[model samples]
Target chain A: MAVASSDTAIRTSRITRAFIYLFLLLFALFYLLPFGIMLVNSLKPLSEITGGNMIALPREWTIEPWLSAWSTAQIGVQPTGLRPYFINSLMMAIPAVILSTVVGALNGYVLTKWRFRGDTIIFGMLLFSCFIPFQIVLIPMARILGILQIAGTTPGLIMVHFVYGIGFTTLYFRNYYAAFPTELVRAAQIDGAGFFQIFWRIMLPSSGPIIAVSFIWQFTNIWNDFLFGASFASGDAAPMTVALNNLVNSSTGVREYNVHFAGAIMAAAPTLLVYIVAGRYFVRGLMAGSVKG
Target chain B: MGFLDIDNVTKSYGAVEVLHRVDISVEEGEFLVLVGPSGCGKSTLLNMIAGLEGITSGEIKIKDRVMNGVHPSKRNIAMVFQSYALYPNMTVGQNITFGLEMHGTPKEERDKAMKEVAQLLQIEPLLTRKPGQLSGGQRQRVAMGRALVRNPDVFLFDEPLSNLDAKLRVDMRTEIKKLHQRLGTTIVYVTHDQIEAMTLSTRIAVMYDGYVQQLGTPKEIYDSPANLFVATFMGSPAMNVLPAKLVERNGALHAVLTGAEGQEIALRIENAPAAYQSYKDADVFLGIRPEAITDPEGADRNARNIQGFTNGVTVTEPAGADTFVTMTLSGKDCIARMRADADVHPGQPFEFAVNMDKAVLFDPKTEERIG
Candidate 1:
């Protein structure tokens, strides 16, 4: 009986290991293919890219597109470069991400651990507001911003992004806070930690994942936003997203695909860098918050 | 003067009352336990005393100072929650010294207190480990140590041992009892586990339906419960309450019980209440504890009259040390405790004795004690 059992165990271990290796190899190919194609296409000259299939590597690669995207390029009569738009996007996304996440964390701390009236109703409204499309309110939102008299500035875009970004950030933090054992909060309270003390010392340090998630989401939303940025910002205050759109879809100009693609990559760079730096926190945040809710 | 006094405390959520008019006073160095079933308002009362919850219409005093609106830290009370409530992100040493650090104890004094508490709890070697890295028993000791370092006016525990495993719970229970004896501080503990109440408390307050049913020493509460609720709530396997008829026999009161074989047994009741004297031929409930009823040939048969009450066993369950025998008397079910060597068998009826002198009688309609 012992001999037969040992043989069966050995066979089972081998079979399971083989299955795992096969599964991993298949997933590796699935992920690496698209990235490889995007790299090759980005490096190739525009003539080579449009002449051949995307899978082929370029015989001649040039850095002119990358350099041009960083310097002077214009779609309108008044000449201006993409540099200011890149800086504007940076100004909008970073502050929007930071303020939205800070507010979300505070809101989460109040709603979950503190028992007060109408907390559930407020949370439900926040979640409901996140689901509404931004286009539905863009016109009214633009008028409101205009009435506030800060329509064509960086701060106005930051405020608009923060307002739209709060719903999702709160949803992330609130749901993450719910998974925490409430006993910890009570213990902090008993330890003489008042509202801000508990939030800053005990709760926020352990809140790395949720903060990363909230930042990434807000960063991407603000960086990639075109309609709001276009409606709320004009002239030199417009973000890199609108600048890249003008480069690609100009009403009547020679469309430079290389500069537009490079500019597009630049516009998407901030969120992508954020994702790389906080990659583990982002993954853990998704696993912890999204899986539960 | 008493160390702590709770004056006519009452709690209600909206229209439904959870705790009703509870008054208790604890002498210095006393260990008091409030025990009941789920939703019995024991935890609510403890929370109010801890200043974690506001009192609806009551006042709590610690060291002669009224503590109604005071915050928990200002009240000088430390509570150990059932969940241990350790800061998960903190090490054992940090958790123990958090309360001290908050109260502005100097750095050297805080370290001294941490050393003393860690040594007392035997958690010195676990100082660097966070709560999640420790075992359940270790976490429990750290929780106790957290409360110990404060040296507060009072210690409140809300079912702190309910989360431990069975063997750990027994070990922790003894440690808590020993700690009370050694430290001589005021403690108010709440639990639904009756054995914890019976073994650890200087006094046990039995609560039910938002009211204190009875308050007395452990022996007093066990031997002389105030009502049916107290009698049934305090014992393991519970007290056997059988329906019977009260009657007058030879100018004395007796309980008339009919056995399964249709035989009538006349059990003499001593010092019967005046209300029961007029309850002749009236249906009443007979409350008898398991220990009060014994085997016909048990050792305590001579000290008390083994014939004061008698019943026949219907089933017997031998639990290694003692046997529990279920019997039917007057068409009502009751349990009796017998020796393990009694040789009682299931489905075989055997004669058993009941100590009517210690039995309590309750009115069937109101479920209240006759006396």
Candidate 2:
């Protein structure tokens, strides 16, 4: 770690740098073994996976399992694919991520810049949402969802995730903005920019890194949620994670292990894509707020 | 009413008042400087004038209009912050025109105003660049340009040059003074450096402990400070304040004190103020600047009462342009400023000249000026 931190140190010691890279490569291969196994089996035929080595390369490699998992797979006595549930997850996650981020940014701006009495206490109470056990709130959340009359719907899951996501998003934003200079806000006020104008023009423009952090965080949490999807949502309204479970556990004919691996990978694909695309900004955002916003 | 009136304004957070009954009225185009050490309420007073902070009581008026509850932007005033506060995401052109844009000015007019200010401040080439790309001096010019393009009724500066290096600070100080002269705009600048206050302001209000100790012209504040705080706070190496006896000698008033040689010396008062007669034989403090106590050759030749005395020099520091010699007077370390070429050294009994015309007396108990 120390050898990689400085250019001079790395240049002066080739043996140490080589050794560090070798160690890191070994660890990388070790960590990727499970993912490699899953991908390798997902491409093999069902007979090869049931009777042969799980880690062995297939003699007849085909994408039949991935296609079957997408369209014709049996999930809870239906031949309908996991595609609809994928759309459900996307719908729930995208709106939840966006709305929670906007709300969190506004909360952070008011908490740090436009401070009023007992603001810290209000923020403390809001933080309770982050720490409260997800299981503990299951009943109350279900009650609220029932009262809203949108139970078992995509919007219902969005509301659940959006409300639950605010605490973490707000936490990220407030700390980032706390390091921001208040003099800039005062200068804007003197320059005749109103509250919303300053938020949109001044605060939001400068909040790129934190917004990326919030979006990535909320999207991953909301998209991969199985407990909430299983407990509250049902049938066609179920998210990809719930539908993937039914595909694997349904006591139907053939018990296809290849299709189960494919369905599991499909359920995990969106989060992997999100992380791969936004991974660089996620690290930068966390580091920026951790060191100095 | 003057062009700007800060009449009986006092600011308090809750029960503790930070500014106490402050009253200063600035005339049209007068540069009023509020100077003090940090936390002495100089910045607070400037904020109140800019309407960034509310005035606790007593109304502030600009052009005879009450501005107690007016918004900062509605007050028609602009402020240059110590940090410059330029928007980092905007180009210099946009930063300069942001206020005009917010005020609903047309694009053509905003562009024209920004171009005029950029050219005036000699930053036309930097207009396309963001503030993050500009140097410290260029950033300062942009901040000032933002304030100037508004053509405000008043310009408030809260230690704007303090963020610069010493050389840049001096250069910017001169530029700000030149801009003030060319525009003749009423400006209330705040700084802890007394040199800036003296050089830049038409009138200065020296504050300490939430009180404006004195408000006068630079000459008045320096030559005749209202009290001990003003006298000591306004000069470099601060004014020498030592104990003395206001005794009558030879039918005239004299401030008698111990010289460096452990012998009594009497410096006569040439034209004593009328109240000095009443403090006969009473303990008082004598105030004198380092320049006032000089080598006999470097003494003010035109001073009516240049009383000469011999004192032992303990330390001689030959600073360029002038040499400072420290000696013991009235059992306190008194420094005297002498010529750079003055032949003086430690352990030498040097003959010093005291100009009585520049000397002021302060009452011992009250610390207020007696003469």
Candidate 3:
């Protein structure tokens, strides 16, 4: 975007630009150093990693640890792998992200366009809920889960993440829709459209950027959350984070460092994929809701 | 009751009332303009009529049906908003017929109605283009087309042409007036531009500070204003108001004021209203339009009493077809309109003609017209 600007700003010498680029490149490589070490040690046998330098390239590359981490990594006294937990995380994150985003969009529509008495207070309370710590709700949530008799289930974990995530999603959507002209809603109402019809036709079509922002935010938070997963879910219902913790801890004596690296990378892979795919819209959507009057 | 009636309608947000007892009745095909400065409750009144804002008191009826507690969509009324309010995601054709589709009209019929409206608006070539891609004028046409496609009982226009440039505003004003003439649909338009109100409206309701200062035909509002507010608000170079005293000389009513040189000048008033008989020696406000005072040669030949006076010009502004000459009368800058070629300059004494027949008198105490 800056390259297209024909503005006459202060000019910099070639050597200065070269030094700036070199500094940025070095900082980037420094951040990537841990990931580089993890990647190089994940492919070698455990014996080689123990005897050799961890930063060095693989002496003998093999897929045995990858296969072991995916299946047969002895996760919690059972000869199971992180694959089922990965699937559990996906199932939990997908529905929770979608439900929270949709409900938040509805909340945003009503708060901005169809405002009623005490709406600002309701929105203020929703925003206040976002700052609440997860530990504060653990006891009450556990009690509710027990009463509902679905404690430690995948649905229960999804419910926990969903209940906690809607506040943030609503905040994003409300600010974004605040800048949307209220005249369009009034015009639609006069055009014989009802409440939900206006929302579906007039509003949702232009909500692409904000929805992308909400989806990326909710997906990242719910997938990376370990506290809620460990507390609300158990056994085969554990998310990938809990399963990976079990895989590393349940191993006795000789630590399979190579398999641990593989399992850790596997747990972080989905979030990495999400950011790589939709990260461009994160800043764009945030800016859309920020700079508008 | 007329076709659309706003009967003693008042809108209040809690304790503060923005609109107070707005009573306007429009016969079929009558174009009533609700015009005022911003925050004068003109738009609020338009919204109340459109059913967008609920009325706190009184009632609004369309086609003689009471519209209280009725939803906007069920009111069968259409409004063209100030921003145009074209749906950004829909194309021109779809935007035009969205209301019809929402009403469960068949696909083929919706398309037919859309085409007819597009043809009427001469936007047939732009049907597939989205609103973001269209120019400002074209988007305005599509907005009007959207309202026209519905064929509702009453059309409410809330400053629709204000978003355009100066030239486009004039052009669209003409187009709207033409549309009203062709369709003969009852329209309640709102605007702050007084010229639009005077030109397009069959009757103009001039508002100020949440009060309807005056309501009458454009000519009536121009020639016979109800108060000082209407007289000053309805004209471009607003009607000049000079403080004067009403006196009786030679057994005829006369308005006596000071000239530019501080000399006493008296203009005889002929055919005065009966109310002036009681205001013999009381102070009064004399209102006269710019065009009513012109060069001796440019004065209206048909005027019954064109009184000539000599005043020193303080300013001369050449405005193409007419030259506006300003001078001090009764210690106020009184403007006189003359032909562009009138040899007028500042610091020069010139003979100006005043058409006393067109002059209006207001009571100094109440500011209301004397008769």
TM-score of chain A for each candidate?
0.83, 0.93, 0.95
Q: What does DockQ come to for candidate 3?
A: 0.88
Ten-residue region with minimum lDDT total, candidate 2 chain A: A1-10
Q: If ranked by TM-score, best first, what sequence of candidates would result?
A: 3, 2, 1
Tens-place lDDT digits, model 1, residues B1-371: 47899889999899988899999988888899999999889988998998778899988899899999998888888889999988877888988998888878899999999999999989999999988898889988999999999988789999999999999999999999999999998899999999999999999889888899998999989888888889888889898888888888888887877887788887887677777876788988888888878776674744454454444568888898999888777777777888889867777767676777778888888888887
The sequence of per-residue lDDT tens digits that candidate 2 reaches over residues B142-245 is 99999998989999999999999999999999999999999999999999999999999999999998999999999999999989999999999899999999
lDDT of all predictions, in order shown?
0.84, 0.92, 0.91
**What's the true lDDT of residue B317 in model 1?**
86
Give the top-scoring candidate (lDDT).
2
Scored by lDDT, model 2 comes in at 0.92
Q: Is candidate 1 or candidate 3 better by lDDT?
A: 3
Error of 1 at B58 (Å): 2.1
- Looking at candidate 1, what is the lDDT of residue B162? 95
DockQ of 2: 0.80
TM-score of chain B of each: 0.96, 0.99, 0.99
After the best TM-score superposition of candidate 1, give how far the Cα of residue A158 lies from its true spot, in angstroms. Answer: 0.9
DockQ of each: 0.58, 0.80, 0.88
Candidate 1 wrong stretches, greater than 4 Å: A1-38, A46-55, A72-81, A249-254, A276-280, A290-293, B273-276, B301-304, B308-311, B347-349
Candidate 3's residue-wise lDDT over B129-240, tens digit each? Answer: 9999999999999999999998898999999988899999899999999999999999999999999999999999999888888889999999999999999988979999
Candidate 1: C-alpha lDDT: 0.84
